[model samples]
Target: MLLPDLVRTAARRSPHAPAVRDGAATATYAELDALADRCAHALADLGVRPGDRVVLWTSKSIDTVAVMQAVLRLGAAYVPVAPSNPRPRVQCIADGCAARLVLADDDLAGLRTRPGQTLNDAAATPADCAFILYTSGSTGAPKGVSISHRNALSFVCWAAEETGLDASDRLANHAPFNFDLSVFDLYGAFLAGACVDLVPATLAFAPEALTRFLFEREITVWYSVPSALQLMTADGGLLDGDPPPALRVCVFAGEPFPIADVLRLRAAWPAVRLFNWYGPTETNVCTSYEVTAHDLTRTRPLPIGQACSGDQVWLDPPGADVGEIVVDGPTVMLGYWGQPAQDGPYRTGDFGRIGPDGNLEYVGRRDHMVKVRGHRVEPSEIEAVLATHPAVAAAAVVVVGAGLDSRIHAAVVPAGDARPTMLGLKAHCAAHLPTYMVVDAVRLVAELPRTANGKVDRAAVTALWAEAVVRG
Candidate 1:
């Protein structure tokens, strides 16, 4: 089935059910369907045709969700641009997709055009491009990942079944629409006739407000980057508050969940089913691990688990225990937009190994490996050990200098009121890591720098260290 069909099916099954909620506004399945129809005709009048790309640059709201459904109804691929993104980045994505038209929040006021009399469910095929998600490229230009309807449905269908999502489930849409993590929150809910509560960008960083919002909305299924979860539990005192009885499933992806933080969450909400999902945007959640009591006792990072339904995951150079992760199956993206089509498995550029338990253990990214004193080191190894420290909430290792001058530096974010000392952290690292792998310098900071998508911005972290060196 195509992506739009998910909403259409839900609309038919439960017309009056709440489909999406944003702030004070709520859209029922029937209203959402009707809005999409009207928006589709409006786009058609504006010269948008089947197969054309339309840019949806708006904040998280029911209108944004309606625009997406409208684009899908017309058989056109929608490229979502976060409202927080600068104008230049929006322009870059529009130009890259050769978008036929750009629709912003302002356009919603005028989207009540004449409704299209007929709905063409077959306007787009399973193989047709569904959406283009742009991710940061090393070259400073964003590269768009083109995903087909089949690619998205593979994960959406599996997730709905695996989690037993139903009309009763209230999913939290935490990630911005532009981010791939939001795809599951949006489509997965629609596929299961569930309701989605759109979390506004303004409240995403305000942990206290967000925590209250989650309970107020009666969020049943929560998904976001681990950093957001950490912030909610750490600063918002989520654990100190009364337990949210409605919260049943909690899933985190986008980055590793600090082992200590995960343990804390497990202790605070032992009844909730927690999941650690792992994958890049190119492949939406290829592997996931359900948190168990034993997992909380682990000092090392948790395993990413096996592949989900309709997906195949394997390591490159199959015989080796550790190698780059390679993905094959329906969920694999078509390719980077404007790039040549690739065959066989998509090399994820991430390193991993099959452990004795037959689970996929993430070993950091291949590009993240750096050479210091002629010895190769994976920063995750050092970061993992440092994260085990009671005082360290999060840690990132970056390599600085060149050749003989090259050295590894560690940046740490303290947990609670525990102030970490450079010498103490060094001694802690000495106990676990090789002398060569031990960082040359350590700095404590209030928080780690993060990109728009919530991943650690290594370059920004390096700049912070560089600025500190200059001041010294």
Candidate 2:
């Protein structure tokens, strides 16, 4: 069945049950289904046809989800552009997708279509493209990852089973739709006939606001980036207070969680099942590991766990230092839209290795690997070491240079007034990491730059480092 089929099924199972909730707005399954039909009819009125690309540019809200489902019902592929994105980036994505229609909220007066209307409700074959997600390009131009309806359905089916999601589950829609993590939040919740609480953009970043929304809404399943979780852990009385009564599972991805923070979360919500997930936007969460009772060490790094329910992960044996992660699975995107397909398997550009326990562990990005003088350096290694320090709030390391020789430059947000001096931080790295991985320079910042999806904005950090070097 197609993704929209799941929504229809949910509505059939519980017409009056709450399906989506925004600040002062909530839609039961019947209302959501009827509205999606209206949206589909509205798009058709705007000349959108089957297989047409439609851009749904809106923040995390119930309206965005309705438009998404509506596009599917009309047999058109939905392209979700993060509302937080810059104008140029949004326009670039629309152009790249060759979108036939653009839908935005506050255009209610413009929608002259009636309810109980739809272009189609048939399943898209595996060969039919469902959506195109554009990656945040740090090295160059952004590439569109084309995913089919069957490709995403397979991943969410597995996610639903693995996470024990069901009708009783109330999943929090925390990530922006532009980020692939939202795929799980949307589809996984639908597969289980679960309610999706749309966390507002303003509240998503604020720890107290997020905490209030969670318990107030009785969210049972939570998913977000590790950085956001870190902020919540650092907040006063956030972790120490009573956990959300309905919270059962907490899934984290987009970046590695510091072990200390994981432990802190465990301490705060002892009953919640914690999982560390890993995947690129091209592949929607190919692997995951559930934290166990005994593995609660504040100093250890969490493993990326085994492959997902229907996925296979392999580490390329390039050399001893690192290898690129290669994935072959249904969840893997067909290829970048408008780009030629590679004959071989999808190579994730990420560096990783298979541990003795047969778990996959990420090292860093292949491009993120820097050459210091003559030695190759992994910035993640230095960042990992820096995060071990009590003073570091967040850390990002980037390579900067014009010639063959480059230096390791770092941006750090320190905790409290006891900041680590550049010399002392370098010494700390020299002690833990290899000589090549030592920081050449450290610049303290109030906060690390972030992309629209909340991931570390390496491009912005690189620009700052380059500007500093030129000024010097």
Q: How do the predictions measure up, each by TM-score?
A: 0.97, 0.93
Pairs of residues at least 3 apart in sequence or in different chains that clash in candidate 1: none
Over 4 Å off in model 2, which ranges? 117-123, 298-300, 318-321, 341-344, 402-405, 466-472
Candidate 1, residues 1-472: lDDT per residue as tens digits?
8988888999999999999998899999998988888888888779888898998888888888988898888899999988878888899999998999988888876886665455664367898998999888878999999999998998888888888798999999999988999998999999989999999898887789989988889999999999888888878878887778899999999888878888888878888989888888888889989987877667667788999858889998988978999998888889998988657678999999887778898888888988999888899878988998999999999999878899899899998899989888889989998898888898888889988777888889999889998998
Give the Cα RMSD of candidate 1.
1.3
Give the top-scoring candidate (TM-score).
1
Error of 1 at 283 (Å): 1.0
lDDT of 2 by residue, 1-472 (tens): 8888888999899888888888889888888888888877877788878888987777777767878888888788988877767778778888887889766666633453465654456445766778888885664677788888877988899888988998888999888887888888888878888888888778767887887877888889999999887776666346766887889999999997766667767777778999899989888889899887767653546788888857888878744545888888778787788877534567889888766666777888887776777787888878888887778877999988835667788999887576889888888888898887888888998778887678889889999998887899
Query: What is residue 126's positional error in candidate 1, in angstroms?
Result: 0.5
RMSD of each: 1.3, 2.2
Global lDDT for candidate 1? 0.87
Candidates in order have lDDT scores of: 0.87, 0.81
